[model samples]
Target: MSNQHRMHGVFAVPTTPYNADGTQNLEQLAAGVEHALDTGIGGILCLGATGEALALSRDERESQVRAVVEAAAGRAPVVVGCMAYAPAEMSELIAEAAALGADAAMITPPFYGGLPPEAAIAALRIVMAASELPVMVYNNPHSTGTDLQPSHLVELLDTGSFWSVKETSGAATRVRELRAALGDEVEVFIGADGIALEGFSQGASGWVAASAWLLPEQCQRLWDLSRDGRWGEAIELWKGLGAALGQIEDNPAFISLIKAALSRRGAEQGPVRPPLPSVDTESVDALLSTIDGIEGRALHV
Candidate 1:
């Protein structure tokens, strides 16, 4: 598929499911892929922040990517997150994803010891040169320590090195700026669920949403309403889902919350791996309450 086609619409970022023993759960991964596709999402982004890519070992990461790709079965495009602190490592991850049939790769700026803008660009150049799959630059300044300024992003885009950018700067204005700067050359996907409406209003190509993992239908409805210029309905839908979205935005244990919510709905989403604790009973109850409020149905909590 063309980059434009793959990059548009609701792209759900699924959490990687792990069994009680911390082993990869391909069954749940497959179910999650099917569930997301059933919601009419345009694409699936595996091993993303929501997926806890950094927490998984290389073998587990590859298994999760392969599972999602296999389960998707071409119903929608799959974009794998290739987040690494070095060019060689990132390139290898991208290669694994490409071999597993992923349509694209999403990369963040090198972390740990932050790369300067020029160095970051150089790293990206190496990864881009190493793979044929389309690339989506992920701008997550909070976690990456290095923010890709608009000018720097434009420079990278000018190299024809990237197909899109997942803007997590939490600034809707940045989306507008990117659109104004690069026009249609680089698609800008909003990475913050809280600012999705604002980003879409500013011409964001789509959303890379964690909330969409469990609430895909609602998320997709909002995306469609906004994309079709039905601002009134879009805003209303967004308001209705705000409580659920806020849980993700406010909670540091959001991945656990997401998996818990899915489990409440009867999916064997499994538990989050250690170093990342599971949500407390109160938090889980609150999340389910929020979901129930938006869904208007008592989930099997």
Candidate 2:
């Protein structure tokens, strides 16, 4: 399939693995990409929120993007998340990603000072002008502290600066609102894993999911069922994986949980970076139990 068509599916956002000495484990990052491809994911998103982009230095971020792109090697589209606070920085990142073979760029609004809608537009325009790759506007108000409402999104779409929007507002209704406003002109990717089913049901074109890092098969199944109009089956799958899916919402240290889960599955994803502690044994056990339950159900089915 063409990269544009492949963009609209389960885009796995893998965590950035760090060594015990607090350095980027590029080997593990590559392994994560291979794992995603092996499990039949549609695309890979590196340096995203789940990938802990903000905590890494510029060099580290670029290295991670290069590793993912090389590992993917055209097997799937690689999207690099640009979370810089300035347009110049975002542009530089996007340029580097494009040079390294990233299929697209995912950018959030100018953060830290919580820029208004107009400023966000300016920042996006600057980045859009700087890079040649298609841009996906990431509307993650929870972390960015700047919510790009439907109106702001419509304005951004009007500028023709974005190819799609990753709505992480944790609201299923936002999907309908975006579809109504943008009408099929722009793609809408559901960013919140907790609402993947609901958002897809409401006309979301794809999912930018963090859970796919560990639960790749289940995540793909969820997307397949939803896309095939098997709503009842999809809802049942979502309910069965509720505990595992809720980790992203219940814990602020979700990257840690992602690493822990991967470790349980025998992937050598190392520790999370500093300022984010490792997942506690109790939490790890709970996540393992949840995964075990899901696997058991799959066996029965």
The digit string of per-residue lDDT tens for model 2 on 1-301 reads 1245336889999888778787878898788888888988989888885456888888887788888989999989888898788888888888888888889999888777577877787778777766677788888887777788888777665444467889988764899999898777678998888888889889999988888988889999999999999989988999877568886557777888888878877886787877876678788888888889899999998
lDDT of each: 0.82, 0.82
Worst 10 residues of 1 by lDDT: 292-301
Indicate the residue-level lDDT of 291 in model 2. Answer: 85
User: TM per model?
Assistant: 0.93, 0.94
lDDT of 1 at 68: 89
Residue 298, candidate 1: alpha-carbon lDDT: 23
> Number of clashes in every candidate structure?
0, 0
lDDT tens digits by residue: candidate 1, 61-113: 87888888899999888998988888898888888888989989998878765
Please give the RMSD of candidate 1 to the true structure: 2.8
